[model samples]
Target: MTTKNVNLVSHPLVQHKLSLMREKDRSIKGFRELLNEIGMLLCYEVTRDLPLEMVDIETPLQPMKAPQIAGKKLTFAPILRAGVGFLDGMLALVPSARVAHIGLYRDPETLQAVEYYFKAPHDLSDRTVVMMDPMLATGNSACAAASLLKARGARDIRFVCLLAAPEGIAHFQKEHSDVPIWTAAVDERLNDHGYILPGLGDAGDRMFGTK
Candidate 1:
């Protein structure tokens, strides 16, 4: 397997928010709020390398100059259901950014990912796409999502998740060596049930307070 650069976000704010989300007794509202906070924090790290162009603009009292993103073609693809939780928070920081949704439900018998839905905006060739999903376990969904983005001509693609398993990271690296992964934390392993061991349970369930 290729060595993938899986960034485990270690910022204090992110760490604090993740800690709160891990509390089993936390309310649904609290879980949702923490997820949003984590999303914004993760976004800060992900956008660090975005292309910036120097531009001149007038300040409140005088003329000023600064650098800003070169274009507005950024697209955030949230693997459906659980990924939606991270979407809201990311959009809070980038309200004008376009969004796409990909749904992948795993088949129990075959243990493979099955795509049920997909939608994205036009002209992705020059756009910077950031894919969001709360958990990266087995890496099937993420790999599929990244492959979809590549098929759409998205050369600059990145994946963001709240948590990741070592095996999943390895799988992602082997499948998409060029794509980079930014995650808040990397757990130890995946349990027999395909869930990340010591993970925060099912991120979708915790985010929505469902079983």
Candidate 2:
């Protein structure tokens, strides 16, 4: 489903993997592997529109002009802990991309995002930033992360996730309408405690076996 600034990746592979991840009984290994696979696929979709420039090159048999991604290397900024799960796969596709880490945890009672750590390339203004977080449930963390990036000079930012809740999307867009979102699915709604209904549990816990 496409919305104003959201792109739902309806690819069959992505959907299938996401379904497996959503299964409550899924093994930790399976969940982590699936998240990695989906991360690679989503990375593909998110970077589809990146600009390219042609350069003269010599092939094995003949000379040619080859197109390569234009501009500075991209920065993959993953919200810490759970967001780290998407990193390996995304980096597998764009190995040279820089990495930025943002650490924010939701306050248990208030459900507001509280930041404890943040680090990124100094040239954020010169590179495209893709922020990865598997679940966009409350949008509190996502919005706060974006604000942090913008304050650090990042102008081009995109958000990628496995699943999102309607409330989260609304809250995110309302605050950072300029940043587009790409996700595998948009779940029905968030539960009372800010978890997405039918979401694949706590992403950090599931991925890290912390629960």
Candidate 3:
């Protein structure tokens, strides 16, 4: 079942940590840490409704039944550099999850996505895919990346990001309404160059100290 498409994770801890991440002068190390920490928290919300199955297990003494996540394998596909920042934190929550990488960058004037790299494990139909990226500004790259995955046979896919813009969300839903969006905040709007205003700047630069 397709859960509600867009999710705004407004938990207090998420909000406070996101605030820390938005500071322009914040150190790269500090921003990276907060990104991962918040990624874990968002992971909690994204996986909340995953199916569970009961199984018999032996405890310290007798055998008893316990619930475990249904055998729905998970794949975390991060969109290149910035998205990688959220992976470690998410792995802490689901170490067994496979990782996929999709490399796409926006064209300067046209703002369209150009793919550079794509990789995934086999049996895409059996696994749930979570696309990770720190910022969803114009939604070009995210939508393009999700389309690539769908072309490869992935049926269950969702998106997770730290920040989003309304224009981005609308464009994303228009293209891929079946995929849900989980984000920490939806800022005011995207600036002329397609950057989210009041956003934490270029996520790749902030995460990697490139700018």
Instruction: After superposing candidate 3 on the true structure, give the runs of residues whose Cα lies further than 4 Å from its correct spot.
Output: 1-4
RMSD over all Cα atoms, model 3: 2.1
lDDT of 3: 0.92
The model with the greatest TM-score is: 2
Error of model 3, residue 116, in angstroms? 0.3
What TM-score does prediction 2 earn?
0.98
Measured by lDDT, the strongest candidate is: 2
lDDT of 2 by residue, 1-211 (tens): 2278999999999999999999999999999999999999999999999999999999999999999999999999999889989999999999999999999999999999999999999999999999999999989999999999999999999999999999999999989999999999999998899999988899999998999
Clashing residue pairs, candidate 3?
none
TM-score of each: 0.94, 0.98, 0.97
Model 1, range 20-93, lDDT digits (tens) per residue? Answer: 88877888888888888788888889988888999999999998888889987579899988898878778888
lDDT by residue (12-114, candidate 3, tens digit) is 9999999999988899999999999998999999999899999999999999999999976799999997999999999999999999899998899899999
